[model samples]
Target: MEKFEALIGEMEEYGRSNHVPIINEKGMPVLLEMVRQKKPHRVLEIGTAIGYSALLIANNSADDVEIDTLELSQERADIARAYIDRSAYKDRIRIHIGDAGENILKLSGKYDFVFIDAAKGQYPDYFRKVYPLLTENAMVLADNVLFRGYVRGAAECPRRFKTIVKRLREYISLVSENNEFETVIREDGDGLAVSQRLPKENNR
Candidate 1:
């Protein structure tokens, strides 16, 4: 927890300028483990809020690995760019200024790892867009699927957010039920859904 607190402190001190979303250290350590184990050459991140997660992944990965992050907000992108430029990880991370939904379609390279932390309501759409870009054995890590427990207690959520929550629930359910991939839904910090792309032969 100390490491998480330290990360939070750093975010408070400098990341506020970029509106960086705070992450729980619990999920971060696991994410880093996944990156190290996978040793992905290319990583795609759908959201670049302050680029904290992207930086963390890069720091834990091989030096040759590269991270491409998409961020729609110019202000946040600028702040993320500044932070990356000043940090030792500047060379490994590249930020794209545009909506992830449309921008991801234009991306040509295959990705071994995809991290989704964008608009909660758009996660399913993100998955659909990213599916074709993933290489065999690729992994997609979707964050905040549990919506801080609100997902289970749908009756308790507010009217506006309830729809988003329902959508996320559906997305998780659909992914978990799909035989093409093996999905793991873990309850840690807002909940993380990990889906690994199965080999083509495994589909049948």
Candidate 2:
């Protein structure tokens, strides 16, 4: 346990020094709690930045859980691999390097939990692709849904972020309005959208 804590500390420092965005302190508890409660046997992560959240998920989940994390950058995936290699979960978390949008489609397992922290503008696309791959009652947690208080906040969206903010709104709408999902948004770090799929019999 001590060794794992030290390794996690190093991962956090590395992310900060390198400008890599991992989950913030406020939102991490919510994520870990979900992992513990759901006890998902198969987890799919859309973004693996240094493997911070992936490690956390594996640590909190059941002993036999399998985590498949996707990364767009080879360089970042290498860094994440180095970190995972240092932990007891090296064999549990598999990092796939490629465009996450395309990588998600190639995956074929029924994932019970999905964590999305990748391209904010492509969130709707990611959500749509991953929807069919999820098991019933699967929980989809999306990070940064509220980009800098622009998604549902009163702040004006900048010209540069218009598309991203627009897409995020669409992503939220997709889950919120879907008859098969029960969605809730937490106003934590950036913002986290929690959506749980209803059973087939319960879906309208």
Candidate 3:
């Protein structure tokens, strides 16, 4: 436990110095709690930023859990791979290097838990692509849905980020309004949307 804590501290320092986006402090507890409650056997992560969140998920999940993580940047993927290789959960975590949108489609098998922390503008597309791959009662957690509080009210958002903010709102709306999902938007750490797919029988 001490070793794991030290590693997490090092990763957090690296994220700060390198300006890499990582899960915030508030989001960490939420993520860990979800992993504890769900105990998902299969987990999918859209963005593996230096493998920080991937490690978190792996550490909190059951021993036999399999994690598939995607990173668009080869440089980042290499760094993440190195980190994963040093961790205790190395054998279970697989890092895929490619465009997430294309890679998500190529992925086979269903996932019991999914974490989305990739491109803000493509959240809707990612959700749609992953929907069919979710197992019954699967949980989908999207990070940064409220991009720096811009998605809530775009009037104060910068022109360049308006598109992303608009798309995020749309993504949240789609999840919230979907009949098969029970969605909750949490204000912790840039905002998180936790959505659970209802079973077929329950939906009717």
Candidate 4:
């Protein structure tokens, strides 16, 4: 237990020094709570930045849970692989490299839990692509949905961020207003949205 704690501490420091965007510490509690509450057997992670959140999910998940994580950069994937290799859940967490938008399609099985923390502007695309792969009642958690409060802000968004803010609003609408999902935007950290897909019968 102590060794695992030490490993997590090392990863946190590494993320800080390397400028890798990881799950906000403030939001980890809710993330882990969902993992524990769901106890999902199959989990899908859209982004595996340095494998920080992946490790957290693996550590808190059921013993036989399998995690398929997508990463766009081979360099970051390699770094994540090295870190995962040092952990006990190394074998269970498979790193899939390349565009997550495509990789999400290549997935073979259904997932009870999906975590999205990749490109801020592509949240809606990721949600659309992954919807078919989720089991009924699956929990889909997205980090950075609020994107520094621009998505819901009343003031004008900066020109550089207008596109992303628009996309994020679309993503929020996709889940929040969709009858198939029960969505909530958590204000902790940058922000996180936990949306659960209702049962198939409830969808149509």
TM-score against native, each model: 0.88, 0.97, 0.96, 0.95
Model 2 misplaced regions, further than 4 Å: none
Which digits, one per residue and each the tens of the lDDT, describe model 4 over residues 1-204?
Answer: 237788889999999998999998888998998899998889999999899899999989889999999999999999999989998988999999999999988888799999999998999999999989989779999998888888886777899999899899899999998888889898888888999778778773
Ranking by TM-score: 2, 3, 4, 1
Which candidate wins on TM-score?
2
**lDDT of candidate 2 at residue 28, scale 0 to 100:** 93
What RMSD does model 1 have? 3.6
Give the candidates in order of lDDT, highest first.
Answer: 2, 3, 4, 1
Higher-lDDT candidate of 1 and 4: 4
Q: lDDT of all the models against the reference?
A: 0.82, 0.93, 0.91, 0.91
lDDT score, residue 182, model 1?
A: 89
Which whole-number lDDT from 0 to 100 does residue 46 have in model 4? 91
Clashing pairs in 2: none
**Best by the lDDT measure:** 2
**Model 1 stretches astray by more than 4 angstroms:** 1-9, 16-19
Q: Tell me how far the alpha carbon of residue 14 in candidate 2 is from the true structure, in angstroms, after superposition.
A: 1.1
